[model samples]
Target: MSDRSQLDESGSSAGEAPAVPEWLRRARWVWLGAMLLGLLASVVQLADRETLVAEIRERSPELSQQEVDAATNSGILFTLLVSALTLMVVLLLTNRMLQGVNWARLVLTAWAGFEVFAMFITAIGLAVLGRGTIEQLAGQSVSAVELLAQVLVTALEIAAIVLMFRPEVNEYFRRMRPRLRRR
Candidate 1:
């Protein structure tokens, strides 16, 4: 039989249906939740323009008023651009993950791994330098809501990674692989 004849209407061959497990479906929603939390955190940070400018000024005390203003404007613009790009990436990856794309899962897992590693490094640096040094450098404390949101986002990311690796999800990916190759 021809390869084209083997594929059903849904694009899977014969008996294979692109059936996503409940865990993967839940993982997709968790990813969406994480994305929303991230957006909230970004918005909260962006909303405090005065504080952001004050921190920038504090760090660069020697800068003239005009220079500081210019820097603040540029910084806000950069932040907004980055936030928009991040949102787009999160949406794209979440959609692909829902479609049983193994590469998307791996990419997201790698991103989470990098975030964990960066957190570890920051913690170690803070521990080595002590709280006083950290406070001096940071110039301000993170709000409780922001901290909670960050924690929730991190937990959701870890949960999604774990869910994507479940036996049924893994099997689904495996079954989809050959079909993808044929196309």
Candidate 2:
């Protein structure tokens, strides 16, 4: 029998699986682009610490300058750290997905879903609390460009999720599945 037809320990032919689709390859790039946009948004927010501090002071005039500074600085640092970590995760997961790891696709989809839900909850909370508008909540940005970046990133994430679920991509994942060994 030819090597392609020979069954391995998994009882499956070596060449049984289909190749990854072009759309899925494009989706991986979109995912990376979204992560880059998110990182940019975080940087912009970090640079707007003065505005954040001023807003805090306006909300509570009783707060000392030292307290406002500490709060703003720490908050910006935390956001920056989180954004950096998220970028790392996106890179790792994208690489895995490109390699046709089924779990990676599922995990990335779940992560994107959670992010969308969180953004919605945050927007509702901001509106209810009489804080800034939805645009402001979206990116913590005063500039239009920053706001657009935030919106674009969210859209890209949604698109990536859809692309991952396409029939061709699903077939690729199935083919990439590892063989299970009996005990």
Candidate 3:
């Protein structure tokens, strides 16, 4: 196809999105919900610090729990961090999708993969890295990395959904799919 054919008179591809879709709108809402939840978790974690310490002292009598600040870190730090990251990436992807940038879709894919990796790390920590033999090391601050992953994954999901409406991306996929033949 000719270069001119790639785009319309407005210079954006004919297949590019002009506005965010209902699904994306819903995704945005979901992202907003996650953000609120993260914020709530942070607040609760902050408040729970004293309670956790008191419980530890009364129960274990040998364990020490550290203080937490919502603005910085807390028990829900990883969740909150991930929520913030997801929100930022979704917002950016939503903006880019509306602006009709095809490359944004590719970025979304990469971000999603990164997010899955982060989630894996988080799962590892939540399991083997929790209150085990090396509890102190596991408790060390490390939410930022997970947050980055959340944002990437959210972006990837939103991008994938948005790409569904994108004709160019679909055509590319269709071409890439293997042809099926009846025997």
TM-score of each: 0.79, 0.72, 0.42
Better model by lDDT: candidate 1 vs candidate 3: 1
Error of 2 at 49 (Å): 2.7
Clash tally for model 2: 0
Kindly list the per-residue Cα lDDT of model 3 for residues 7-84, writing each as its tens digit: 753355655423334554454454445445445545555455555454445545544333323322443566567757
lDDT of each: 0.77, 0.77, 0.50
Which ten contiguous residues of candidate 3 have the minimum total lDDT?
Answer: 174-183
C-alpha RMSD in Å of predicted model 2 compared with the true structure: 4.8
Tens digit per residue, CA lDDT, model 2, 32-58:
999988888778767876789877787
RMSD of 1: 3.7
Model 1: per-residue Cα lDDT over 1-183, one tens digit each: 876469864566675657777888888888778877887787888688788778878788999888888987887788778877887897798778777678988998998777667556656756799656766776765565665676678888889889889988888787777766776
lDDT of model number 1: 0.77
Off by over 4 Å in 1: 1-16, 123-129, 135-145
**Decoy 1 TM-score against native:** 0.79
Model 2, stretches more than 4 Å misplaced?
4-18, 59-62, 118-147, 179-183
Task: State the local distance difference test value for candidate 2.
Answer: 0.77
Q: List the residue pairs that clash in candidate 3.
A: 111-152
